[model samples]
Target: MRIVVTGGMGDLGSRVVRLLVEQGHEAVPASRRTGLDLTTGAGLEAALAGADALVHCADDPSQGDFVTVYGTRRLADAAAARGVHLVHVSIVGIDDHPMAYYRRKLRAEQGIQAAGGPATVLRATQFHSLTAFFARTLTKGPVTFTVGDTAFQPVDTDFVAARLAELALGPRPTAYARATDVAGPDVLSLVEVARLVRAHRGASAPRAIRVPPVGRLMHAYAESRTVPPPGSADVGGRTFAEWLATQPARLTGR
Candidate 1:
């Protein structure tokens, strides 16, 4: 399989590239670093030529319109033209979520499906690093200012990347495949997550302020609206605590 991974240098995409290569596939990293600017379609023609599949991981959540929505549509079209299979990565609850970022992700999904190509969309829950970062970042001297009651199903990026590689390398005989989801083994409260961070990082036990949800976006998280459904695929064997145990003892530098 000749796979072109957009944003292949990114955290998740880089792992995808490495695994694909280790499995005897040619993993071409298509990103700004490789002279393929997805936002403006620069260097796409040469990069995508003869590619068997495209793993769409390049996203700019801050610039959702120009970079994510429009950019993804462009990538889909190019892949369609080149007879390449397109596998799109997305979040679990973006379809009905209230956040602007989620709305954009929904648009990107819709646009890619209609953009004329063989496509598969894989929506995943929050990454462990993202959920844990709340604890990792908020633990100032003694106070960890955070939204107290929010819950998260934090999956490992390595698991997410493995699933993507499978989809990218698998057969795509149709114009579009039904979207699937993947999640972590367990869900944890924000405060519980904070405790784990404090224990591992050797940070001061935070004064832990329990601020209630204020906005629709925050409220959505509090209610577990972004978690995967009951029947969705759960691909990891390691729990959050187990994974955390193997991480570096030093706190990640903020």
Candidate 2:
């Protein structure tokens, strides 16, 4: 099978591409770097040409809806027209979330559903790297700030990439369908995350300072909206601590 992965050179997309190649599939990556610009739908038809499956991993939240929303819709429509199976990666708990990015992601999903094509939407929790970055950002020196009972079940990126590759290789649905959510094995509070991060760097655990959830976005996280309910998702991945151990002692950018 010939698979086209949008943003194929990106962190997640690259992993998916590698997995697909390992399975003996022809994997093609399409992005602006390769003359395939999703924001303007340029080179979309050419990218999808002869594509048996397409993994939608390209997204730029910083560009607002240009890439996250319209770009996704454009790709979905084109794939549907070409009778190609579209596999899209999404975030969990986007429904009813106040964050702008999450809202746009939900809109992207709706667009894919309305595209009337064979598509699969896989919603996973935050990746481990992002979770660590959050912990580092919320910690200042020896004090770690927390909002309400905010916690995370950060999934491993490798696990997500493998799943996307499997979905691309699996049977295509007649229309848009959602697969079971995926997540990490354990849920850790904000303070717990901070402690693990500090431990990884051989630093003392930061003093946790609990703060009120003052805004919609903070409140959503306080309620653990990003975490799928127990038994609601297919959880399989390295624990956050396990993943952290494999990383450099001094963490860098997300």
Candidate 3:
């Protein structure tokens, strides 16, 4: 199968591409870096040409709606035209979230559902790197909080990617199906995660981090609104601590 992975060089997309190759599929990486620009519609049709499936991991968190919502609609249209199956990566708690970014993601998922094409939606919890990003950035300050009041199931990207590839390579489901939720093996407080990270990094002191719930998002997270409901999740085996052990940069707060 000739599969095209949008944002193939990105955080989660790269993992899917790697697995696709390991599984003996032709994984074509479509990204701006590779001259497949989605914004101007340049090289999009060609990149999607001859593709048996498309895994859309393309994202620009900073750009929000422009990249995620509208961009996804465009990709879906193109994929539909070419009769390519699309597998979309989404977050777990997008439907009832208060944040604009989550709203945008929800909109993107809706677009995929309404795309009138062959597609499967896979929703996963937060990635380990997202937590590490805050941890690394907050280390520069005297004290930074990991939103300890909030809780999240931070799954490994490779684990999520493995599921995506399976959906993409195996079969093309009909459009408008409910998404599947994939979460981490364990749920931990942000503070607990920070402490473990600090210990792994071998920090001299604990002056760099704190545990506090500040934003509305955090409040929702604390209430378990940011994750899937109980018994509604497929849990992976790799814990945050296990994933952290393999990442030297993340462990060291780099």
- lDDT of model number 3: 0.79
Candidate 1 RMSD to the correct structure:
2.1
Residues 1-254 of candidate 1 have per-residue lDDT tens digits of 78999989999899999999999999999888889887789999988988999999998877759878999999989988777899999998776689888899888988888887899999898888787886667656666666646677888888989999999988795886755688889888776777787878786556768678888876786677887767776657467888888888765632
Q: How close is candidate 2 to the true structure, as a TM-score?
A: 0.99
Deviating ranges (above 4 Å) for candidate 3: 135-148, 204-215, 249-254
- Where does the lowest 10-residue lDDT sum fall in candidate 3? 203-212
Model 1 TM-score, 2 decimals: 0.91
- In model 2, the worst 10-residue window by lDDT is 213-222
lDDT of 2 by residue, 1-254 (tens): 99999999999999999999999999999999988998899999889989999999999989999999999999999999999999999999999999999999999999999999999999999999999999999999999999998999999999999999999999999999999999999999989999999999899999999999988888998899999998999999899999999999999999
How many residue pairs clash in model 3?
A: 0
- Which of 1 and 2 is the better model by lDDT? 2
Q: 135, model 3: CA deviation in Å? A: 4.2
RMSD of 3: 2.7
- Global lDDT of each candidate: 0.83, 0.95, 0.79
| C-alpha positional error of residue 238 in candidate 3 after TM-score superposition, expressed in Å | 1.9
Candidate order by decreasing TM-score: 2, 1, 3
